[model samples]
Target: MNEQETGERDPGSGERVHWSEDGAERSALWRSESGARPPGKLAVADDRMTADAAYKLACEGTALLWRGDYHGARQLLAALARRVDRKPPKEGATPEESFHLYRQARFRRARVLGMLLVPLQISHEGTHSAYSVPLRRAPEVAQACEEAYGPPGEELTLVSLRELQGVLGAHEWRRKGVPVEALGGDRVHPRHGVFSPVRGEYVGLVARAPLPPGEPGSLVAFDIGTGTGVLAAVLARRGVGRVVATDLGERAPACARENVRGLGVQDVVEVVSADLFPGTADLFPRTEAGADAARADLIVCNPPWLPAKATSVLEQAVYDPGSRMLRGFLDGLAGRLTPHGEGWLILSDLAEHLGLRSREELLGWIDGAGLCVAGRLDARPEHPRATDSSAPLHAARAAETTSLWRLAATG
Candidate 1:
């Protein structure tokens, strides 16, 4: 499942921020997707402020409210990033320690960069509301802001320029869409918060894996935690008759529904708002004679690979604390499968390399769940980060492999 998805409510939507300017006190809506609170201290900054001064203030926990040119604020953010990058954390004693240090550094960097803020204003027309930065040289961002935060409200908002840049980038991706080669070059348009399927090796594994013994039209498959519904759509295209794609939150399900519809797999893929599977009884109820509903002929799950707490909405797609989703899928897999059904667990070995998880533990979980591996397919990491030697955990990533474990219920 992917991580980036929009929420029902924008982050910091109802929060208010206060600051003083020219002997007047002012307040505005404080918006943050990371759920950042209003800065405890605020300072108005403009073209006159030096990048070094702004960086110093940001590091000291004072938010710089930009009253300068919009593009200059971006440049200033970039300069801040350059400064932050100057001091890289020392490598730790082990891969696990290195990973933690890397995460901590990243958290600090985002916080420092996020201290640069901008004011957003909404102007109303006869039947339309538009969002823009009330500063010189501001680009038109109404569409991007609308797509991310919903229709513009009357409240003026203060948003981190870093977050706004993310919004703008997501808007572009949604406009062009990410191409999925396994889907015969079709594109999957990811929403603001919904995780995108930029990694294709996993999807290709699904496309080429041997199907369970049944005609495509006769097989009923369940895609657990379907993020963009990309895998569900892929299953449909591969001939699965009924593909139930389920996700927990509001944004993912909605994003999946839209993508599947666009892919013309709406007939075969059913996007559902659910955790793991829809209510178990509804999906696997007893028949008239007390026989179980025909359990899913094929169950596919691509859960978040890392076992760690998510710091933000986007991280949820990458980190799964305690391997909760992974274990849950394994624990529930056997009960929901047909006698001859197959469950595909798509996962990466990066955790193993990082010493966060061990291979034996994963196998033990499967055995405990009454599942036995029937077959396995493996793919080398093709993502850029895997080979980027400069990456903090490059050793682990370079050695990572994604695998699809074909699991069957143990007798």
Candidate 2:
């Protein structure tokens, strides 16, 4: 029999065919059983396709069926990334202007790769390729795909080619761990969907800040919106008696718990499910020993610094719609902080420079909320974007500085 005749058939309607010759050129064909020609044909060739060709096809709305080895597809993707990175800088752009552009590029990349992703239909019968994806890490990638897309049925399982790459990258990062010098040369492995503390300036600022002087038996701290629990772990290591870390994302709570346990700070840090401070306020009663209850000695919040709408759940960490989290944090700060205690607000001034939020307006909100800025420590951002002149927000990002603002309630 010819190669096409021996190929596997789709179990669902038997209308699709997965053809591969020498395990290199794989393609998917949707056909009618009555001998009618296939409607959709995606074939992967042996030669590497140029990014310009791929991108043009992507923009013109065509999918490149990758036939190269799984690893080769990855290399081609990297080449595409380099091309994307080399795009010319926007002239006279503000930081916000640049940020928008950066976000747009990312969004566009996702859109293009999403178009390339072919749907797969898996069953207990075993693996069947629909649109061929050169997945090197098949088991893990398949499992993750299942988790996100649900159990594969006879129907095709839809996934983004670009997002699959991102998931795989995240998996690797989680396995290897991100080096955190503040943890004494240790590393922190961030779980999927949790914010990773790659930008160390903010975490370092929190690490070096002054802790409230109190009875040293068990200092209590609340790490609001603890992403990877890095900040909470830092506080715990700094001799905080107990650190209560809270996050609304189910993934974040679990991620924080795992990291806290890995760091050996589980004894001092407790992970809880919470949307904000109110969720934890129940732990503190209105009357304790017939006196007004005391609040946490330290409340630290590192809200999303940008002022924008998130396109997806994952983007929530980077983009805060209408500055809701920032404003909510400031509004909630005074009530959660105990007398003589400080609320450390770690933030970036990129929004201010972008004309999204004015520095004067933020300060006004602080003062309006009956709080005083006890002290402010600033650190220059060291991320790659700061040095990339071709980036959209080069001017604003180049001038951007992150700050740890200590606020005390003054009612």
TM-scores for all predictions: 0.94, 0.77
Per-residue lDDT of model 2, residues 270-347, tens digit only:
899887763534565531443333368888999998889776656778789988888887887887776777899999
Model 2 scores a C-alpha lDDT of: 0.70
Instruction: Please tell me which predicted candidate would have the highest lDDT against the true structure.
Output: 1
In model 2, where do residues sit more than 4 Å from their true spots? 1-54, 62-68, 75-87, 93-98, 118-156, 278-294
The 10-residue segment with the lowest total lDDT in model 2: 31-40
Cα lDDT computed for each candidate against the true fold: 0.88, 0.70
Q: Write the per-residue lDDT of candidate 1 for residues 186-256, one digit (tens) a residue.
A: 99998888889999999999999999997989888999999988999999999998888899878788889
Q: What TM-score number comes out for model 1?
A: 0.94
